[model samples]
Target: MAGSAFFMACAILVLFGFCVEAELVQHTFKVSNMMVRRYCKNKTITVVNGEYPGPTITAHEGDSLAIQVINESPYNISIHWHGIFQRMTPWADGPNYITQCPITPGNSYTYKFNVVGQEGTLWWHAHVSVLRATVYGALIILPRAGVVGYPFPNPHKEETILLGEWWKADVITLQNRALASGSAFNISDAYTINGHLGDLYRCSNKHTHKLEVEQGKSYLLRIINAALNTQFFFKIAGHRLTVVAADASYTSPFSTDTIAIAPGPTIDALLHADSHPSNYYISALTYASSPAIPFDKAASPYASAPPSASPFDNTTTVAVLSYKSSPPSSSPPIMPPLPAFNDTPTAHHFYSNLTALHPNSVPLQIDQRMFVAFGLGLTPCSVNQPLCRGNAISASMNNISFSFPTTVSMLEAHFRKIRGVYTKDFPNRPLVAFDFSNPSVNNQGSFQLTDKGTKVKKLKYNETVEVVLQNTAVLAAENHPLHLHGYNFYVVAQGFGNYNKKEARKNYNLVNPQERNTIAVPVGGWAVIRFRADNPGLWIMHCHLDGHLSLGLAMVFEVGNGPTPSTTVPPPPQDYPTC
Candidate 1:
């Protein structure tokens, strides 16, 4: 990865033209199985370097990283740097079958790329299967060498908090069983803070994660949601959090009692330890937006009948925010009151209120306009099929469930001009246009079925694209966190009900809309984003919810090479994993 660059002091860094040359950081990850006891149950699960939420990788912006991963576990694996802009190095952008084939057991592959012009918090995770339930860690990028400080007031201390989900059964087996039986995967047994299931759960008191704070000092909390299938609401007992950045992009500072984050995005918030010295609860719980669905209680010990209508892991995970020099008291720590599990208003408020700290030039002219209706659907099952005895659950964009090619990676095929791997006929609009958000539309039989194929949309170099993501209510409408590889986009507008071009244009926040690599599309609603397609490569856009991703809510963007050698994507490296 080679390029020229300009550092930003008071400017928004665009993905195409800037690249800074800096340090070369390296790490070797050993993947293997480890036995861990949690909630009185012992289970052997895969881990990286024998650590649960593997080692954090820290580097300055504009640094190059060469991470060698040796897969010693029984399962094949690949690691994805969630929000890094892999400039001219799409082969290093890890995604099983999309960027490269998975490294098999006993095999090793080195991911080499440069982190150009990105700062603040992001993360890395397994891309092969549900293995990310345990194999993940944070990737923090600080400001470049000459930059004075953060865009906001610098905090006295920094902490990394990873929120995760846990299950007693092997996550791979659980997902395979659910797919084979045409049912939903079992709900998680419990949630974790820094990979510890705090004192709220059975047999977990001694291992609760604790953070000590001093009076009159502020701390920067780099919060990453690594949960496979749920969004979380994080709050402290009696403190306000000032959020400064998200998804490695800077945002205007704002104060909130609770922070709502879906999986695959990072939130950098400032916490002031101004309260009187005492023990405060740092808590997180599920914000399940999906409507009520049937849940099998036999699958998990923590599973119970929903006290209300919606089916969710209606449980809380807690950690202690202890004040230094405070006397130990017998009384319990003070807990914060969280929002309801289906509080869409609160989630929307937190998500939409954010604006970019430094405004960029949002493309005023659009070269490509797309309206993608995405959510869950179904496909008819074969009569003699051993798996999926009934209609198999499926998810899609524009009624097309994305199918992965087996023999070669999508990027490889695109680079080599290999035919028969995928078609460049992905629709700009859905094949069948109907009332997307109408609840009654779910009753239509044909509307619930979708076709599966490896179809991609083609884009010319440097084309500006605008996409309107509309969430559907076929099976159930929920908040789907849509993530795009290789670039960040401006979220211009979002609203409930159907998307009207004329009505939405009035509210487009083109001046300072939030810039993020991932955007949580409103539940049963719509969101619009715009970006310039300058990086020429095969990039995938998909839902961050692991279950929905496996069910096929994904699509690829095939960007053509630029006219000049400098702008074109380079060929793959020698050690690129082959199928």
Candidate 2:
């Protein structure tokens, strides 16, 4: 679980010395169902290697990971490295039926990928269905040996803070029922820090997640928002966080009082630890929805209110950060200020202010420009379908809903010369145009129902592509955190309302823009991101909000082969799952 020290014994010249011989990380994850109590009730939940947050896989940059995943649970499973750019090894990029088929019940799959250029906080999670509710773990990659230290000074200590949601009932059971009764959903009763739901929840006061820290010593907090559908506002009552990195990429330091974290992006913030020698409250509250749009009570009660105002708002989890030599008391700690349920400006400012520590190496010249509008839509139901009592609510990108191919994986179909699995004809521009930010705009005319198909955009190697993602106000105008599979992109510009291309182009950050694998395109707003299509594979891009992803807010990037073998995709491994 530690990075091997730099030495001169096994250095090789094969790969330009960027990759010296480093110890490979080997771990076995046994996915099984276990009974656990949350909110004072015992319920069976899926777990990885018996741990709720599983085991944190630790390795240095340039080291490869060999994770043997053994499935003992009833559900089919696939693990996705959330922020890892799979680079040349797209086969290991786990998206069920995308990169590979699921590792079926009682079966196993070994995911092997090199952490070539990534560092800082990233994570791994089950990519199949709602099973990610309990099956996920942190994948922390340290800096490469003899290459780069952290841009900021090293902290006195580092701690991993995993933010998660805890549901009493199984999500699969709920999904089946939701299929029978369209749009009925339930959110977790409580939120969790690390693995405990803190003392605020019913019967959880005995075992709260707490941290004992030395006074006046700075510590780095690697905070991950693993809550399935809720982005969070995290803060400590008496401390300030100096933001350093997001999504495993280094950022120019900026200080913020309260940090808004989306579901998929990880934050690495430096806590100066300059507070009085007393216990401080570590609080995470729900950044659930934008209050501008009317709530959809018929769909789910999750959007009814922030957790603080709901009946279970008392379930607000709180972990204590105790200063050394401070007196211990069985009392509720003070809470910090949380953003209003609909503070888009605060959320926008937090994301907009971050920049990369260094200038980007990719050229800023745009080779391809794509404008894809995404949102929830409705498709007319076939005869007497229960799931579509009226119209089946769905999600889409560019007026096309992505359908999963059950026959084979996208990578296998592309590599083995199979046809009809997917088409490389995804639209570069949206099918309809309107005042996208107008909440009162009618969706019944142009963009209400969308065509469903398996489609992708084709890109050549090394082509720099810029995509302007505009969020539509069709059903619900909510923040969609888009996660790109195989590459990290620079989020150059984002703004409220419809995007003005000329104005957006003028304001784009061409130098030292913050790089991230996931970007939260604001509700009724637009975000422009640029990435080079250098990786050869069928990469899946989708909304990280699990519900939106299930509803088909996704697309694929089919990257063409390069002239050289190194740039071309390698053959699939022997253990790759077949349908």
lDDT of 2: 0.82
Regions more than 4 Å wrong, model 2: 1-20, 292-315, 382-387, 442-445
Local accuracy of candidate 2 as per-residue lDDT tens digits, 261-338:
988899999998777777778988877554444434544322222222232222466788888878877666777776
Q: State every prediction's TM-score relative to the real structure.
A: 0.93, 0.93
Lowest summed lDDT over 10 consecutive residues: which window, candidate 2? 301-310
lDDT score of residue 331 within candidate 1: 90
What TM-score does candidate 1 get on C-alpha atoms? 0.93
Model 1 stretches astray by more than 4 angstroms: 1-21, 293-310, 382-385
Tens digits of lDDT, candidate 1, 253-367: 9899999999998999999999989999999999888765443344322223322233578889999999996798999999998899889999999999999998888999999
Residue 230 alpha-carbon offset, candidate 1, angstroms = 0.4
Error of 1 at 82 (Å): 0.4
| Candidate 1: RMSD to truth | 5.3
